[model samples]
Target: MAKSFTKMLRAPDSPVKLSKIPSDAHPGVDSKADALRKLPKFAGRLADLQERLFAQAHGGTKPARQNLLLVLQGMDTSGKGGTVKHVAGVMDPGGLRINSFKAPTKEELAHDFLWRIRKALPAPGMVGVFDRSHYEDVLIVRVRDLVPRDRWELRYGLINEFEQELADQGTTVVKCFLHISRDTQKKRLLARLDDPTKLWKYNTNDVAERKLWPAYQEAYESVLNLTSTETAPWYVIPADRKWYRNYAITRLLVETLERIDPQWPPADYDIETEKKRVLAS
Candidate 1:
């Protein structure tokens, strides 16, 4: 049997050296055409499973309390938005909740770091996608020294406990770190500058952040090592190739929903009686 993307991409339990892992490697896929060919099949399966999950929730009196939360974290221009557009966009919109986190507001800053994160969780039977999620509290917040050392340092354990609670409550947390090379990022950034249509996507801060590439990488390495728990493990997706990245994530989503195996709830009323009433009408 072919290996599952989940197994192939899942980060190891021990510490990982990001510098050693190649960002351009495309495992289990031959080429962009190969990935594109396989995606539609996976999309069909994904749509069906998503419908089953949503039906289970809205159907019978005893609703299933399972949901999925896909957390996307990566360096600048790692294709987080593109992944959402291609992968989660193919699923039923009624069953998907997408939230993109940005710089914290004054009100958000008043509360604990996870205050906003708690509100963005996916409802039962829904697939939630977080674009640059709670990890920012550690990643950017640490790299930029937005907060003091002791506070941000302690958030690692807090995040672990929070994810564990989600797992216990039937939430399958799929954390993916979209790994890309420095050169690829530079080309992508340059492309943004070269194209008038893509200028809106570029930010001056991106260049400034690029200068801190090594620091961001070090922070990511720590995140992968520290918070990759058994319940909510991290997957390092080689995202230099956009086609493979989309395909890998879609495969992971399909396998996860299949594992849940949500079923169609039986009708509460008698089918014969309903049929007879409809005929009489």
Candidate 2:
């Protein structure tokens, strides 16, 4: 059941046009209210799995080297931050590493593009969430021509190699591309402008970036096509409705952690002996 839901959301290997996918899709969900209602159930399961994964990694268990990394890529106003707040917020913060990658700082730029990305990877038994990740090198860098086409084009392969290495090292990578319609983006951006509370999120540059929507779409298509691998496949979540977005992502994370099937490590000492000692004390 979880596999089927994940299969439905996984991006196809063939080239895709973002317009072709519905931004408000709610597979297996009846309505917005239904999705909202179901979210907490999924969140609870995710929280439990996270605790087990953390325990396995830190409880002096032998050969403890498993972790989960969720990579989120999307246009501005596509709800990356919202997903983190709603879905990842349920997990134990001690076992989670949430990294938001923005423009490269001078020190970051001085090193390779993935230098900071590698440093931000979650340790064994941790859940790492990247709000905007290494794919930015291929997305905005390509659309805005921050780097030459020749250089950025080569990054797809490098990204694939990097992810493959992560998989080989026991880190399960789940990449999600929040797919929002142009109209939805416009509405969201406008809502930000109208609401004083959300005004801080309203960036004038977002409008400029929206102008190159077609270019951004093309760049993203290239990413989903080139970087979506067996080890680190990309899932495109419809983001028109915030409720559905949260539900889909929470479900995905729940399914993913279930597949990992982390266990609480066995006690090194005899449990009965420990219990007897505690009772005697």
Candidate 3:
């Protein structure tokens, strides 16, 4: 039997040391070629499952309350956008809700941190993708000291409570921490600088952010430890190899949807009557 990336990549209940984890390792895949070969099949399965979920929501007498939310968190250039392009981009757009949360706007900052997050959550039967999510309140905010120590410290519990609430309300939350080596980030950043087509992605702020990599890692470690719960667990994906990162995350999504096992809702109208009416028309 194939190994379950969901199990292999999931963050353990105990503390996780970022340095001890190998960011470039491909846990289940043999090579990049192997991952590339399997990706299309996984993507196809994901699409089919998403269709079932969408149909259940729109076509059922009692719509399914179940939905999915995929949370993607990583350092700069860990391929969160690339994952969305390759993995999520394949699914039907109608069934998917994609949100890329930026720094809080004036209105967002005025409200509780989760107020904006709540607004962006997926409706029933939809698959939601958050590229950089609520965790940033603890991560960048903590690393940059945007809030006081006591203020940010409390968010850990608040995040846990919020995620547990999501689970109670029928959202299957899959949070992935894309674990990339610092060296890989350096290479990617340099590539952005060197390639004309990629030049627009290059940012001076990214260089400045690199200086605080240690602090960010520390913040992430705390997040993985504190917020990883039974209801909304975190999976640490090895992301130095982009192909494996995509493959692993896609595998996780496929398995999760399969477990949900959404079915095509039964037809409300009588089939014979509908057929006869169509023929008469």
Winning candidate number (lDDT)? 3
- The numbered model that scores best in TM-score is 3
Error of 1 at 101 (Å): 0.2
State the C-alpha lDDT per candidate: 0.92, 0.90, 0.94
lDDT per residue (tens digit) for residues 59-177 in model 3: 75688889999999999999999999988988999889999999999999999999999999999999999999999999999999999999999999999999999999989999999
Instruction: Extract clashing residue pairs from model 2.
Output: none
lDDT for 148 (candidate 3): 95
Question: Which ten contiguous residues of candidate 1 have the minimum total lDDT?
Answer: 53-62
Winner on lDDT (1 vs 3):
3
Ranking according to lDDT, highest score first:
3, 1, 2
What is candidate 2's local distance difference test score? 0.90
Tens digits of per-residue lDDT for model 1, 1-281? 86699999999776799888889998988888888898899989988988998888777868888999999999889999998898999988989999999999999999999999999999998999999999999999999999999999999999999999999998999999999999999999999999999999999999899999999999999999999988899999999999989999988988888889999988878889999999999
Would you estimate the TM-scores of all the predictions?
Answer: 0.97, 0.96, 0.98
- The C-alpha local distance difference test score for the whole of candidate 1 amounts to 0.92
Which stretches in model 2 have alpha-carbon errors above 4 Å? 1-3, 276-281
Q: Ranking under TM-score, best-scoring first? A: 3, 1, 2
- The whole-model C-alpha lDDT of candidate 3 against the native structure comes to 0.94
> Residue pairs in steric clash, candidate 1?
none
